[model samples]
Target: MKKLVISIVLVNLLAACASQKPHETTAAPAAPVAAAATATAPATATVAAAKTAVDPLNDPTSILAGRSVYYPFDVAAVQDADKPLVQAHAEYLSKNAARNVRLEGNCDERGSNEYNLALGQRRADGVMKMLELGGAKAAQLDSVSYGEEKPKATGHEESSWSQNRRTDLNYAK
Candidate 1:
């Protein structure tokens, strides 16, 4: 277990170093001291976390980064899997009072234009309600139905349809 943990930590440190741009440096490498290194690890981790929290919406690893909530075929309600995403956005929005979002509801091509529009509205409204309940204020949210007009996927299959049946969280600039 210790070897496995050490190997994972080594891989992560190497990856972090590799991701940085090259820079001129004359400083000597810090000496390896396991106890001292472990003691400072939490401080480094806290700083990294604080940096990400500054703008979690743009952080791909953050739960708030998920901008769309998908539903099963013809379903207007948010699935259990999407609840966490919605809650994350709600918390983020609540904390950042100035940030506003639009709930764009969409649907697959199987339904008539009117039916799709209505369904899309239902989907968007459902997400809006959940966001409000989770902590976001109603004033920060606007609901709109794009119906089948815009699609994340263009193929005519379950893969595409699944993508279309979603409510997108569009943040205002």
Candidate 2:
């Protein structure tokens, strides 16, 4: 009977030691498998979702007729040769002066926000001045500077940046 009690005590002591010690293998492998699954699963899902979405802004039919003039990047200092384009746009605006028009000036993200804002304002003002010269009433036109807030394309190349820098003409709804 004493041997039986001693054997039981030894068994209980061994069980306690096993429970108290750190679990070195069983817990460690599960953690890495969980982390690996988490890292790869969501990334592929996001990419697939992005591929399915369509961009509304890229539709050419949404562009307004009179306001759709695409200007070169940073043509603030318009030369004598380029004066005709402005003149043509001004004439178009004057004819539709009864309808309110809004000019949104924009720039690429290369410059500081403040500087870009000022530059965009100047570009819109340049167009406004030409329209006024062509007989559009001052009240008919409204100008706003968007700076680098809206980009035409999401590329880092100069071509994409150049396309981003221009004024967009919006007619009052």
Candidate 3:
């Protein structure tokens, strides 16, 4: 009976540790993948499931699948770490001309509504400009500011603010 109780406590402790750990990624940087995709011929989708199930844009292995461009507090510029994500999406957009993407700009819940809206717009525009420079056509991109009104995290701390300050790449069908 003592052994069983000890085993249960050990199991609970292990579960608690596992649940508390943050997600870690060892995936290689996104730039090289984008460059490779640009150099190679478009991959053929042989199976019907392949078409919908394995879209490069949605594929976990593809850099194009990354959609968020996180920003620093009070800053609208894209971080160096996230630029590759933007670049990959740019390459994909240039290759697939029919697809349209909306950049939704957001801000943390700390500033005046007017100020946050402007900052969010700047964030979206910054990404839009980068995409254009990366070969995406102006017609394929659009930007909208949600500002403090739409936050990814609800908490009023840095952790939450970090998530809230981002430009989301929302693809249209």
Candidate 4:
């Protein structure tokens, strides 16, 4: 009878110890632990079930997925319409220090090569400034001008030109 009581006390102590210990990852709803079989085992299986976060950039519904900021003809400033897009990217970059982005500036086919290149640089730089102001580190950003070299649309119409004048936020792998 004494041996039976001691065994029960030992089992209660073991269960208490298991329940009180901290978990590195969140544990799921615990099952009724009927026996002492799992007392000494590491909880790797439970850790594997811990929830993981999906990156906002990869989530199509997030504003961070809107990578391109468009501009009017010969304009270098970011438009009011695209401010939210830039702000979201800026916030994401600020949070994820390991991530880096290249701001690629592109222009329409209406300007001289030198002029277009300079304008594109200004456009890229403008977005870079906004990102920095919004809390992203300068080290996580790079700006470059492609000028008219990388056109999103090849046609000479306003529709095509509108598509071409922009800066693209390209994330590094």
Candidate 5:
């Protein structure tokens, strides 16, 4: 009789377990580290998105987009209209210490090659000095004269001359 009763109890327990659904099994709670990471996922994504934004140098909307600073004929001075351009470049250079620039000075087709070369050198040097004074490091700036060899305009008129007398700011690769 005692053996029959034990067999009946074991059968009942087995039947109960077999009838339960698989999803009824209890699960351990999530880990603290995993919970924290899940909570902050959106904030982390936001920070990464902000960092991926474009740099001002490559941005089309920035004032630093202007590369050429035009000057009057035979003048080495930065014109009133172009001063802000130079200032913007200087600010950029100062903020980015690893960046370096080359100032290429050019002249119109009117002058002799020798005279044009010298004038171009003066123009490049003038811009270089201004950048240095505006907070750029001396080591970050270099000046070169292309003179009449690299004229922007080929005409003999004042319009072309005005376009050619300029300093081009080139960033190092």
Candidate 6:
């Protein structure tokens, strides 16, 4: 009976040992540290998408070099100095009449829409006159008035208002 009982106890112990996990002799081969590095690396396609999303106008040099020119409205009263800028634009247009150019006149938000529209038209006419003087044919240039409908800056402050009150020359191919 003692031998049977000992055998039964030994069998139970063996079964328990079999169910439990065995102790590892060596540490898991330093789980490839490079896996963590590769996981954190930015995807190539995502990086390309991010690059493509950047605005071209964010660069001041690009804005300045572009064919579009901005003219101050009220404060910088139309003066003799502005003639040269207009002339340069006219020359550019003469050289490229096959391409159409739009002169958008804008005004500050100080006046009613009607008044602003008239003022914007006058501003555009002023630019047109100069362009004509500079040799841009009437057929090549088109003028439109945004009035105060579209503003370069949204704030009510004078600085923003000043920026909003301007003419923009946009060239289209």
Top lDDT prediction, candidate number = 3
- For candidate 5, the TM-score is 0.69
**Segments of candidate 3 deviating more than 4 angstroms:** 1-39, 42-53
Badly placed stretches (over 4 Å) of model 1 are 1-53
The per-model lDDT (C-alpha) reads 0.76, 0.58, 0.78, 0.75, 0.75, 0.58
The TM-score measured for candidate 4 stands at 0.70
- Each prediction's TM-score versus the true structure: 0.70, 0.54, 0.75, 0.70, 0.69, 0.56
Tens digits of per-residue lDDT for model 2 on 31-84?
543453366467987645633562112222211222433344455644333344
| Global CA lDDT computed for model 3 | 0.78
What is residue 69's positional error in candidate 1, in angstroms? 0.5
Which of the two, 4 or 6, has more TM-score? Answer: 4
Tens digits of per-residue lDDT for model 3, 45-72:
4444555666677777676766778766
**Could you give candidate 4's per-residue lDDT for residues 57-129 as a string of tens digits?**
7755456657888787799998766776787788778878999999999999988988999999999999999
Residues 66-98, candidate 1: write the lDDT tens digits. Answer: 688877668998876577678778877887799
Candidate 4 ranges beyond 4 A from true positions: 1-53
Error of 2 at 39 (Å): 67
Error (Å) of candidate 5 at residue 170 is 0.6
- Candidate 5 error regions (>4 Å): 1-52
lDDT of 4 at 115: 91
In model 1, the clashing pairs are none
Q: lDDT (0-100) at residue 59 of candidate 2?
A: 23
Clashing residue pairs in candidate 2 are: none
Per-residue lDDT for 82 in model 4?
74
